[model samples]
Target: MDVMQRMERLVEQLNQYNYHYYTLDQPLISDKEYDALYDQLTALETEAGMALPDSPTNRVGGELLKGFKPHRHLSSLWSLDKAQNEEHLLNWNNRALKLIADYNSKNPDSPLPAPTYVVELKFDGLTLNLTYSDGQLVQAATRGNGTVGEGILAQVKTIKSVPLSIPYRDGTIEVQGEGIMNLSVLAKYNETAVEPLKNARNAAAGALRNLNPRTTAERKLSAFFYNVGYSDGISFADHREMMEFLKDNRFKVNPYVTYFDSFDGVMQELHSISDNRSSLDYLIDGAVIKITDMRTREVLGYTDKFPRWAVAFKFEAEETTTVLESVSWNVGRTGKITPLAKVEAVELAGVTVQNCTLNNAGDIERKNLKFALGSRVFIRRSNDVIPEILGKVTDEQDGEEIIVPEHCPACGFPLEQRGAHLFCNNRLECKPQIVARITHFASRDAMDIETFSEKTAEQLYDEVNVHEPSDLYTLTYEDLIKLERFGEKKANNLLDAIEQSKGRDLASFLFALGIPNTGKSTTKVLAEHFRDLTAVMSATEEELTVLPDIGGIVAESIVSFFADPFMQASIQKMLSLGVEAKAPEKSSAPVTDSFFSGKTVVLTGTLHRLSRDEATERLEALGAKVTGSVSKKTDLVIAGEKAGSKLAKARELGIPVMENEEEWIKLLDGEQN
Candidate 1:
């Protein structure tokens, strides 16, 4: 077949698989089979030498929103000043102690008791700032710029994990929460992953950022509302009771949260939480320990970032021992080789540490890691990050070194030695290299092939002669069904996906191509400026040097990628496949103007934005400063109709009010440039 016919067929085949996996959640083609087709296309395009803008390789992160609209947070969201270590935490406790002492000195008859500390898991996910008015959900946003954020209320509601409305009535409440994705879910997703997600945090972040709320919903994103941002009608004497009341109201509270009276107790629980963190399904980076007494908490108040009463206690990296079963090396897009240690499963922190990344040849050699056919190796999970091997124990070891491969495991190409690393020079000919390249191309931050799971990707590798993403359009349903675990229904679905993927946004397509160091955000900037992949490829390294965030390293990577024979061939294949690499339709909104500009606004109701991040980002961009509570310094209060105490306080403080989205947006429009 001619190149054009081969490319068109390749696009058709790959689209079917993409649709079945991403949209329908049913995969037809085995991953390895799909990869083989992608490989052929990549090779052809490289040979032909051109970039296809609409090829699955492009859809990653796009242009930054010109500027987000500002919404006033009903409660001013403050950042927690960090307590770096136990010493800092102890000092904070002492400060709290002194504050209580001074309070008792003023009121001798009714002295406040010793303060208790509440400790909860500090999730590493995005921060969700929420406002509730009269027991109804209002604004939800991210903690963008700490003061304003993108408004994503419509999208936030779609997450079944976040309650649409609070259970209580006749009261206003402000809540702080964490949006979390479990490690197990991430693992399950990665198990079938074409390219395993880097970590759960990245997965959750990507899922949260998706424009399609349905995608967020399918991710099973969950939230834990830990703090009352602002509230009326209901009051808690302490943080513990507040959490309890939040749970009583059906908010998904963190169950591991507890209260302690002494620093020793706090320390003990910190250790306990750290020891058991991996056992929990969700990912947690540290523990948040907060003062319980509201009265004392008020005196302690907050800094610009975090609450003075609260501090996150991060656990030290933990190390454990596991038996090294095998050593395998995987080829990377840069042609660098990474050694992986396969070990018998052993518990560490909360989850089982099974496999660890050895990084490179230098890493393997530096540790003197000679694994007996079955000897114990010391495994360490550093600060809840991906586990790695610190060293090997040769003392009375049970296993000997498992030989590292001299050639590519998938394509049988001779490996090349480059200072402390092994390289697969086979480029387009190697199956492992091709599959990895294609999978990286379709990743969320890359081309964003949502349905490309590891299992399917592997099947494509093992079954189909297909090697890269561009080759996907060339496969037939029969080819897909021949792979293990794929039937006719599944095969048809995979075929359908390949068809749909042809029309994705341009930035996403660039990201899918798996160029080294060139991620989603970078892709967006380049796509917007160049307007097409052809321009990008034709541009000189010097021309790319001036772009924002694109420095010497990134510019070098981009230039090197375009210079590669394989990349050139893949681009041609994409063109032949009829992939359109053009910039997406731009939003008409002015880049500078925003609603909150030059306004001192107080938020006093539930918001439609995702959380405080949304509201903060909006307000900041438009030149508005959002404060926590109503005070003499306040200017205007944007009360979302059903605002609670802050609303009343605003009135008492004689602040001007814009009662709804119409008036608020109108007032904002009047202030804009």
Candidate 2:
């Protein structure tokens, strides 16, 4: 077959596979077989110097748009009128029936019948409007103000479930759907995600609006079409018929859609959805009941903001009344103090809720919450996780008002408010703060001290003289055996882990120092730039800020940390305890013809050809300063699979990108830009 024919065949096959796997929840081919086909198609398309717009390769990503253009929708996407209870649903139904009757009386020849409702799950996600012209996807937009929205065609094209080209090829059609992040996808994503998304709705919204389509692809967002915003080629007798048409056209329609002859049937279905909501893969905040017949819907038209033909039956919030026993301040690893409310145990969503997050002092004050001892409060458990206090339940101010702590709970140091949070100024001196720092220093990501635990750190702090990172090196087996649960094996293993940690590389050692704003990636950048701990400690804020990935705030924090006499003393003590902080030796490759010579490069995402360590070494060997972030000063960015914010920023700044391992290796071998 010719190249174009082969491409056409591949696109059709891939679309079928996607439909089966993502839409139908069944796979006809193994993942390995599918990948082989995909690779073959990609190579053919690249060699042919042409690619169809509907090719599956588009799912990988697209060139970043300069900015989202404003798109005026063909029809205004009206919001649903909400019904919180059976009474509300009945009232709406009664009003809708009366409207239909009035229309029937006015037009005697064409009488509108009593409205039958079409019930569907109300997916808790961002609303999207997809426009198709002649069966090919043309424009995709968000629901900004019902009438207009930002175009997000590139990002939407990355969703595997969203058909790039449909079977119907007649005229322009607009389909409305909810772009949802599956609960399972969110859970898997949060497993390795740096910042876990709060909920599926937020994740879906964030992915849809992301500047880079690559980021959106990584999110694995799905869409479920329910409404027809506008259509020219097709006509449907009812909402159910339109939904069936959407499903037949390869659009994902909600499977739970059912016809309800009466308000009682609609209420039953609404309750059923609410009861089993936790078992569903996607989030649904409510159930929507719409008039079944197209003619009846027209007769009972729309209000100012909502459709009169439909009403969203909102599920009652999962909340319960509980008594606030006491409020306590807990210092986190970063020394930021957060308020924890000890509430009287209450069952919410089949789980016993005790402590609830107060968020911050501002949240408590804004809620006008009396965090006084033994006050009645309402606690809600949303998404079946960490419960939160909604507000005070009683008007009586029967207990003492909760006050922000003046001193750290773990140590006696004075607390200072930084923006909305309160932080302990004493970094190394506080007991809990010191233990947390030491525990983090020995964490596997930092120093790879596998045997170290927070419990051990606390024990050592209270019983032994272990107060800082340096104190950990001073711990002896004799001192450990004196603790309550310490035995010979455990103590020996912990000591061995500590000894091994002392020999960690400069990057790990830098991270182990518990420097504020310096994560593992930042540590790697700092180590590559300065080459040693001494250089980093002596560097001024201006010098540090100029280095790759080091911003003004981080530089200031670094300088301030090193300039402190206590931090200096701690470092000196650690060095005296035989801790060897050494930078990795450079490669012997000559740097004269290197493309990376004197360039600052940031590496984001996962490289297939080399591990992150190996890639960093290669870049540094060629006189490049490898960094963790992309900034305007960055000369190049080597982006690989699943690259996120850094890649977006690099493209936004018009920084050059090395897309794959081959390009990166070529550049390392002195290939010209």
CA lDDT, every model vs. true structure? 0.69, 0.82
Candidate that would win on TM-score: 2
Estimate, for each residue in 1-673, the C-alpha lDDT of model 2 and write its tens digit. 8899999999999999998778755578999999999999999989999789889887666577688999999999898888877898889988887888788889999898777888888888899999999999999999999999999999898888899999988999999998999978986886557555656777899998989899999999999888888988788898878877887898886666778778788777666566556546777777888888998877677788888888888776556788888889988777889999999988776678889988876656655574456788777676556887756765566777887788898887999988768999787677778788889888887888987789888888888978887888888889988788888998898899888888888888889888888888888878878888899999999998887778999999999989989889999998899888888676366565678888999987768888888888778878888887666578999987656446645764578998878877877666323
lDDT of 2: 0.82
- lDDT of each residue in 1-673, candidate 1, tens digit only: 9776677677556655654443223468888998887788777677767534323322222333333356666667776656667898888788778878887999889788788887777887878887777666677777777667766554455444455445587777777787777766765664444434545565677776677665565566666678887777777788878877776665666556666778899887776666555556666777887888887777777765667777777664356678788888777766777888788988875577888878776655555565454776777685457787756656444557667778877568788887767888887677666667767766655555557776677678677866778888677887888788888888887777766677777787878777678877788788888888888887787888899889898999888888988779978997788667657676445335555556677875556633554655466557777777666667888766335446544653457877777766665457554
Model 1 lDDT at residue 272: 61
- Using lDDT as the measure, which candidate wins? 2
Candidate 2 at residue 71, lDDT? Answer: 99
